[model samples]
Target: MTATGDADLSVVAAALGDRGRARMVLAVTDGRALPASTLAGEAGVSAATASAHLRRLVDAGVLRAEQHGRFRYFRLAGPEVADLVEALGRVSPPQPVRSLKEGTRAHALRLARACYDHVAGRLGVALTDALLDAGHLVGGDGADSGRRDGDRLPGLDVVDYSLSADGRTVLTGLDVAVPDAAPVRCCVDWTEQRHHVAGPLGRALLTTMTDRGWVRPARRSRALTVTDEGRTALVDALGLVWPPPHGPDRVPGERTALSRA
Candidate 1:
């Protein structure tokens, strides 16, 4: 890399340096294009202040604005931006919870939330664990030699995950229309410090869960809640017992033995 490249990197870093701006960036990390007004609320900033922040982010190429009729919406410049944010989260310290609402929101996010269009948090890590235990997915040990994409760089938390034949059967049974030749990958979850499904397979799973009302997004937030029906269905289909039994031996990301319905 050249000196000019270092300067360019610093510009992007500066755009994400502010608390308000960082909040705004994270608000859209789930791949949603949000209006400036909503983004301002997310950042807890006045409209004028948010406008300046958004402009800086746009100028730094960290985010892009789209004019949708009378409204302008902002989103991450691309998947690379989202990836960068996720990477940063892995090393960032948790923000202190200052209020009951903040504490609740924080817990909810750590329990279940979306990470760039896929299920993340504990729910995601559990699902990945369940799949692995069931022999539905394989090899997420950050060994790039086993990675499906040979040319791809061994970036942050690059796990060599792939779907097994049984995984195809499981998705088909769940009525998740697997995209043509979709790649299965895993992301090292920032909060859980464990693997969660990613790539095309992860997107398909999230879509299926949402469509089936298994999980619903929280209003104005990326957190998700599992429905009653979903709870039952997940157990029957994947042997994923949610709200796992409270016990001294309970492990994070642990799931019941895979039981096919």
Candidate 2:
């Protein structure tokens, strides 16, 4: 809902009320357009049923469909829709896993997947923690904005964070262009139940990683696998030592440091 009471929110909520529709929304939360048949498979619905659902979503302004050659692909209408899906994930119960393939995909998503334009999952949360631990971000523990957030859970602690001067230097050194204005927003992670960097700094970090070939988008999915170079560079950037003297278990010797996140 907006600042003032408005019925427009109802339109969005109703569009999201259906389980199949919600599945389709999550399927494209990675910001990729998928053919209707693929969305039908993702949502486990018949083709005719999926078509009806897609039409409703498009009409509701939550999704957009484009025709390319003989195939019609659909994607979330905008980043705002992606944000709404992520927010819903924060509140909704985890969907049941019914097969080995689904289980593997779910696990991968929980490890290091993109949350719209920014990083998320275990990787996102850990990076946020490292930034705070390294003094590169300022005012965590509900102090960054100097104003309390109004819509979070009743007793949940809200930690807000901002980029520090040193953070600017670090990002510059990585060849990422930081926005002039501070865009500090905390996004709650569904699996971790913790906050990850989600504003401008988050966007720059993702872009820099992708541009430098430190990470690459997984085919047909939102999972991002860190390249060999990323494993070392990420550790250096975040000052993360596997199994730090006062920390948790060591990350696997494998290149997947997402467990550290």
Candidate 3:
């Protein structure tokens, strides 16, 4: 690589070097373009500080900026950027569990919330397992049929999933419209410590769900909430049973209603 290439890498490194900036990147990676103010809160930084960092990330090609009316929204440039974030998360040291409240929240997030831009938590973990069990994904662990025993839950391993022939058929059967691309990538959640669907295929699935009003964003937050119709759709299409009489060992933040738009 030449000096220019080195400089480019340096820019990305610098932009990601800060915890605040990295959080900002993760916040918008899920395909939601957010304004600087929203990103600042997610990054836990001052508006001016976040804006400066965002500018640097955009210049480095780690993120893209779009101007809409009076607000400017930023997002990861592409799926590749999301991949890099996931890769880093795998090696990143775990932050100490602070308080019972914080721990509970973390558990909840892991059980059923969004990881940056993708589904995570228990839901994410279960979905990943369900895919494998259904012969939609392949090539992980020592399992011959690529099926793991029990509910491995999420965060057990940084799962790598490739779409199987049956996966395509199943996705279509579920009414998930995918692009021309073949297999999709998965990202390990930092909080849940489990793998969630990511990459192009993950993005496609999210898009389909959002388009169909199955899922929606929570107000002023990065988390996603499932809707009544979404619940029905999951059972009908993906065979996902929810609202178990008993919840998981840990539940995160307060439950918010699902929204569309």
Candidate 4:
């Protein structure tokens, strides 16, 4: 077999070599399609500078751009890019919590929120537990797997997730339609120092919950608020319970919000 030209990894590495461009990529990896101006602010650079970097990322195939009237939105090419960002985040040192607001936001993200297209925080942990306990997910039993005996509930160390045969039956019974083809992947939550469901199944769960008005996003922040209906549904459908009287508090620097996952 002939060698397929040089790997694109070099190009990807070069594109991410700049601190500014890398930050831009991280900002948009949240699964939010962002305009160049918003990305510029997130990268702390001028719009012109961000545009130049964005062009490089687009050319390198690390990002994709879509134009809507006057605005051009950019996002990571796909879930593969999200996976790369999450892996890098796992090894990268955590940023210090600078202010009371930052600390609060971080806490909120760790409690209940979305990381890109998937869920994270305490809400995310709870959902994962409910799925596992209900036998909706399986296959985390190998020696190399993250799960351990005697672990606490709502643990986020799952190596992989899949809809069990019973899970499909349960979903069908609940009238929650699932796609014929869905991807199964994991993402690391920086704030919680744990992993959460990502990929198709994860996205599906988020969409279902949001559509059912079980949860809602807090204004101007990535934090999620569980509604009364959400609490009842979670308990009734998945056997999960929310912590009572939940309130915001500060977490240390090492554990912060998930950047990519």
Give the winner by TM-score: 1
Ranking by TM-score: 1, 2, 4, 3
lDDT of 3 at 183: 52
- Order of models, best lDDT first: 1, 2, 4, 3
Which candidate achieves the best lDDT against the true structure?
1
lDDT of 3: 0.64
Better of 1 and 4 by lDDT: 1
**RMSD after CA superposition, every candidate:** 4.9, 5.7, 7.6, 7.4
List the candidates' TM-scores in order.
0.85, 0.81, 0.68, 0.74
Error of 3 at 35 (Å): 1.5
Task: Write the number of the candidate with greater TM-score, choosing between 1 and 4.
Answer: 1
lDDT of 3 by residue, 114-184 (tens): 55456755566455555655567675521112255476633324355578887888887766776566656
Error of 2 at 191 (Å): 1.3
For candidate 2, write residues 53-98 as lDDT tens digits: 9999999999999999999999889887877787778678888999
Write the residue-wise lDDT of candidate 1 on 1-261 in tens digits.
Answer: 544533457888899999999999999888888999999999999999999999999999988999999999999898778778877997899999999999999988888888877898877877776677677777653222324556664554455567788888998899877666645767767776666787778898999999999999887888988888877887778766466332222354444544333
lDDT winner, 2 or 3: 2
The CA lDDT at 155 in model 1 is 50
Off by over 4 Å in 4: 1-8, 141-161, 180-195, 218-223, 244-261
lDDT, candidate 2, equals 0.74
Off by over 4 Å in 2: 1-5, 8-10, 141-160, 241-261
Worst 10-residue lDDT window for candidate 1 reads 244-253
- In model 2, pairs of residues that clash are none
